[model samples]
Target: MHRSSDTIGAIAAALAKAQGELLNPEKNVIATIRSPFPREESRTFRYASLASGLEIVRKSLGEHEIATVQTTAIDHATGQIQLTTLLAHASGEWISSDWPVCPITETANPHRMGAALTYARRYALFALVGIAGDDDLDAPDLLVEPSPTVQPPEDPHQNRPIPRKSNGSIHKPRQPKPVLSAEPSAVLRDQLVAEIKELNGADDLALWAHRRLPTKNTLTAEDARMVETAYQAAVGPLPGRLDDQVTPLLKTAQKRNKAHLRFVAEQPCLVCQRTPCDAHHVKFAEPRALGRKVSDEFTVPLCRDHHRQLHHHGNEIAWWGNVQIAPLEAAEKLWQETLAAPRPTFRSGVQHHPRPKADERGASSRDSG
Candidate 1:
């Protein structure tokens, strides 16, 4: 019965191909036979035999060969045998039996079949994009293959194995030790303290003014002592006053004037009243004059956003001109207004200038009494 079915299948496959209905039917049968079998212990041997035969045929013939097969199974209740033949195409499509079947085509490149199968196993039916033909295989595709085991590069600076010496040997370079700047010794500290105490008692403002003035880069120990004493007198007993804060402030003010002294002259941001505000010069100082340490009256402290806004609305703020206005009065007024006046609801983040409220108008009328 099996031999008769095979012959009938071959004849049917040939007829289908002659009729231009089947194309490369052999691969289609191989694909069907290679498909996973259903769980039936009785059919295990049959399934294995079919798989082996399909594999052998696939090895002997190229993947493009066409074939077909027919099977007749007896319907026990009807007591009739039904015969059907299927033409299998290389593209894995099967035609005939009871209904018409669509012919499948080779959509993927044959060379990338292994890679495609690997990717399908890993990613589960993930479709590859832009893979057309042989031309699509480039350097990127070659790199996708498994690479050989690569050894790490050797370090050139590694010490070579040498014979041991009788005594421990040292190989120090004959370079002279570099001389660092002379730091104030313990003796200098004691002298500095005494001078600071004396300067504190004498004239504090003079000491402060002296510290603000710049000294030459070639200042001696005596000059450092004098500067330290003056700085201590100005700042008093504030924590980290001498070294951390005072010295840096004085140095900055001296080197680039009070404008460059970030903390000394800077106020809280005008908009947010936040500390560490940006230094914004109302007048654009010439780049050349920046290093001269000239005291300019046109600088102000503004946060980043407000500084940008100041430049954007330069014409409005320009009314103040290059005149240096002290922030103490403005800050005092703002504080007073916040306390005594009705709190004005800000529509946005900006604070509008103070205006007379209704209560203030009433109070003024009553004060006339």
Candidate 2:
């Protein structure tokens, strides 16, 4: 429960933070992020880009120093390229802006790299276009100035005193003018009146209105009428008084065995021994009269497919009762009955024992003679 609460709290906090960032434009700024593949040792190239006011640079460093190269800068507004030669300088090892890098021997601020790249790009452009007044170099075909910022006008209502015209003279006053409350529009008033009339005709609305207005306490006639009308609209005409007919059932099946029902769903099916199973009642008695109580004897587990079959054929109660019987005893009885039944028999032809051999007897007599 504590873990769940913590997770909810974290999610709520994140949503609130995101909403705050969106609503407050001054606090939000666009940023570009770049990082090198730390394990690779190839020659690194410097990259530069603009986003909001944030510029980003990324590069990898090897043992060899980078060489100076001539580069062309494109003018955004004029579609012209200015060429200039510039040296590449290493600014030491890079580190994460938001996290500390303990393993790196040298570390530089992440934000500084972006700033340096932006300045370098601007300087290269200016030099190529001969903006610094180099007489030897010819000016580029097209030159453009950097973009400018535009500021909005201040709001008159913000931190300003209200002006009032008195006796044909305008003057600022220390206190603000009293604000008069506006009346409801004619259309809204007409709509409310129509709803009130509709509600007055309904008995349920009258009861609800009475509850809202409270008969025991003092109430204006207009207020009572409004409440009565609202109640009538909310509840339609009924045979008995609103309170008498709206009584909750004493033994609602939905409430009595909620836990048992959940257990039935979670437990594996007895026949298939697989999840998840359906809970079946053992009797086809009136469902409403059974109430909400769940008992082991009354409930049986069946897989979804089997449960559907039982319901489809109106055999759910009968199947449940069969499962409730002692399954082992039934199986044992079935086995015993199978064994007791007579089976087909076969017999071999009869064999008789022979008397002493005549040859043996003759031999014995001759020996004696």
Candidate 3:
């Protein structure tokens, strides 16, 4: 260390000795960042904003005498924001540390760039000060816990088939394209039927698909194609597709309805009528499987805060039930109005509309591959 820095070091040591207990990172910082956008399908959450992280450090560090936190632009190209935490001692000496942090945003828009800077500053402070906070994006989705009554599968990977590598490319084995004949032969049909049976029963799933899609049951060629698609999608061909934004044919209908309901339901908090809302399905009509409330068409807008309130406090169950009753003319009117209004082109952080691609039968989807 420089001889000149010795004096500054001594001052910092003494200050830390006297006030170290006060800088509890846990007390100051929000450990778990509650995401504004939570993907139910993936069961993941987004990180907190830069402003939030910084405020914690600022508040915690202020207690140390004559302390100040400043963030300066360090690099424009790499989008690094340097944060400096400074403390000036009474002996005409000061101690400081500079933590340079990189931007997190992938895109380079001016607004987004600025936000990245703020995020960098916030993280830099956390790094330099040893603040503790859980990064929401770092964790994976929670898996379903095994039921005590049921015997767990011997191999966790038992049913998982070897993923296909493309033969077209060296990276993935090339899968033989299924013969696109008018319909498969009896043996092939039995095989496809067996595959579908292994999954969430073919009858219920097929029935669900028939109800959702414009297809006939059992006999129609279209129905057969859908069953095949559903089987292939579930088994091996489409790896990692179970977690896709667009559910495969057998799995897609309910999720599709939910997505459509959410997109069309956007407006304001139904209770307070404000933007930055959530689509809360009013289930007063009837409770369906997978916690679907009536149909997704019943989804109405509710601000995040109020939405939480409804879920947390169920004292108003009767009132909520009343909203679900048929002849919901008022709800229908609101739905029509939103549909009639111009569609919002942008929904910050969320890409792709609730509407699915045309080929996918209006099921919500994104670049799952």
Candidate 4:
């Protein structure tokens, strides 16, 4: 949150009074957008449009000598759109908050993106003004009574007994036979050998040849091309690996920005909604070295159990893949927020930061791979 230093006290007092008297915008739009899931049901969603929300906020805050402005900008580094909501008082004091606006659909459809931006702006404005609509895009659909006419598809062979042959043996379906390819030509064999030789030394190539091609009688053209492609991929030019070496002194001097860590710890866990999380260092974000963690900027908010589970998962990159969480992108986004407006470090004697609630703690995720 940003505010004018000279008129902070005045703005605070005015904001508190305005919040007490602010009015919520009416739900003016009822939409029936289809669900992304194929099998799940969809429901009609009611929300206030951006224009309606702005009307309410302007009319309400204007009465209290306050004005508001909302704007959007692109973050060049991540190519993500950010919406900022600013509230200004007549006393020359102001405060604002920035939120990342994300599109639901993957395609670059202008209409869908505009809808996402509108949703974000409406909610951000309402949230800043201390009011909200009946529902929001971020919330899950509320449970409702199921329609009596709608029923699940019935199984055609429910409770049927297994088929048996006349010999009293259970019948089994035949499996498809594997198709074998024709033998590779001598020219293809020579090309494969050359490709392997270029990728590996003679000894390594001989070892691979012995294991994969026991005899030329078994090798096919497909097999030769497959071997050639495998060698190329194994030693080919690729994205930079995080396991590359780094200087010891440079790794040691990596900044442990307490302010960034503290800010990240305040956010809800990426897996669950539990707050007051641990700033988990995503080790794959930077080079791995003996007894060294990645810089603090590469951290994600995770609970104690998830943090511990991540460390013991054996493969950090694969573990993140299973849960569909992009730690590097998330960390970079949060770090960008800090860079836009720096947060102060924690004061002395406040070393023990707030912890998650008792109920929120120790709730291990069953599918946290």
Candidate 5:
């Protein structure tokens, strides 16, 4: 501890040594984090989870003689939750920073406010160290692993000082926060866009465009020609590559996934049993990038409104009427049940209508278009 009589040189030396050791990124203390709660629309953006942040401070900074403490207070003017972080040095000197928690509103429900404050705490501490995630160029965090309950710093703003036991540790149960997701950072988004553009060359792109143009069926020959001509006019002449003569078969994994989603959308909303649904891809297997998404086969069909709700407030436990179900796991189980059902065979008496009119059937209409 520093005394009023302590020499200035000793204090400076101690802080310099600690700062130099702490700033090195090469140390194993920092971690690369991929968020468990990525944006429902995309997974390209992520931030350090609270667990990861606490782990970093406890493990990384503690080793360097620094301890992080937080003081939570309400910004009365804005009525926003504020979390202030104090990075204390072993020498009894410290630096503190405070930021208002944006997601917590003045009129938010208590539960929501608690959750938002929890999220803000993690972010404030994580940022103080200048560490970053892969997507940080940023967004919102989880931990399934067991860990210690990180103690909060003494809240100086409170009327009374918080008491500590003789051992000098306090126990506090943290309310887990849900992510308030943001769009991908400009740098990461640009990198992804550049990667996609560089993925295919001019010739390949021209042929890909040509094949995508409607060349037959729901589309009249005249319509097909018009589309092809327009495509050429806009982008340029088609490449010398061969035309896609036969319609593509639904064998590729991508095709199979699309077909499964279509089939699921045909059914009633899995949550509310409502019609006209959107197929939401839930967690299954490992998470992948937006462009290399997991198949729609793992989706749960929900109405547009419910789908938005899930993206917003639906955690692992979703309340549908009197039932509490984990949407992803429930959807997986539903899919498993279908596998056990026997497929019915077609009888000779039933005639297959192979030739479908464009206006009557989607397949023909798609082809014609």
Candidate 6:
């Protein structure tokens, strides 16, 4: 606090008188901030305009023989902007306070510096006097919000204020705002324009264009190209088209074994549990020569009814898909198990083969001593 050589008794008394008649400044200014970080939800901030706040306090102070002057200067020692508010009484007694000005931008931004100076003057005046606007007292520092119509400098390296805490205090430096280029790609622009012109007067062109364009106004070349790119991606051929091609047959050296087919036939139908089945080959499981049956190792047991149903379906893949069963997987499992089983051993001139009970179509092997 700075004061005149005389004690501040007269000014302090005048300030006390003015405080009783002072009205809380009206919050007349509205600011809408669209932040890009942490998702793009817009927030609305309401604060008193500097002019409105000054009018209210000055009117009250004048009635009580108190005059106030606000001035700005550079603190040479610290190289900081300082706002000094002086309240002088008619008796030569005065009191003043110096407040550090917070710059909106780090660089020497004339426009932002002007805004910062105005912001500092209002807060400092309110503090010197004993009054505040609604919610203004709660804010630890002034918040400099730009008007919507004003475009900021196109500096890519510009810094933005840090987001306020829940209590509205700024404890850290600001972050850099994301910059979007204004100009659109020239090649992309022409291509999009040509395509759009061809669709003129189409029945749904208006609606389609409205939905595609970012806004109703004439779209920039860049925006039009973005829409075209998005549309092509939406209607373009999907990835992994190779999966639709037929899988080539995987050749193996193993010869067909009738005994494996016989074992498969002994099992129940893959679709139904009725016994006395036929070893049905899943032709689609592997590619084969025309009119040649697949190896017995690929045969799965099916009852006479299901076997006929499968042939009627014609598309083996489609039939398996409808039945919600994988005969190819079952066939491979059964063949491997059968091949791994020990050959029948003869004891006392009698043939011995181990037989395990079948759980429906799934086949298992066992050995009997």
Clashes of each: 6, 5, 9, 0, 4, 1
Model 5 pairs in collision: 217-368, 218-368, 219-368, 219-369
- Model 6, 119-152: lDDT tens digits are 7888788877977654533453446574569767
Q: How close is every model to the real structure, measured as TM-score? A: 0.17, 0.17, 0.29, 0.37, 0.29, 0.35
Candidate 3 weakest lDDT stretch, 10 residues: 360-369
**Residue 187 in candidate 1, Cα distance off native in Å:** 7.0
lDDT of 4 by residue, 246-268 (tens): 11112334668888898688777
Model 3 CA lDDT for position 260: 49
For candidate 2, the TM-score is: 0.17
User: Candidate 3 clashing pairs?
Assistant: 165-172, 165-173, 166-172, 166-173, 166-174, 167-173, 167-174, 269-274, 356-363
Q: What RMSD, rounded to one decimal, does every model reach?
A: 32.4, 34.9, 19.0, 19.6, 25.7, 31.3
C-alpha lDDT values of all predictions: 0.36, 0.36, 0.46, 0.64, 0.48, 0.64
Per-residue lDDT of model 1, residues 79-107, tens digit only: 22334444454545444342111111111
lDDT of 3 by residue, 272-342 (tens): 44567776755432322321335554555666755675665442343343333222333454444445544
Per-residue lDDT of candidate 2, residues 121-186 (tens digit):
544533322232112224422343657878879877788655657775668556643322223333
How accurate locally is residue 359 in candidate 6, as Cα lDDT from 0 to 100? 56
lDDT of 5 by residue, 193-214 (tens): 3433443333343434434322
Worst 10 residues of 6 by lDDT: 360-369
Report the poorest 10 consecutive residues by lDDT, candidate 4. 241-250
| lDDT for residue 111 in candidate 3, whole number 0-100 | 78
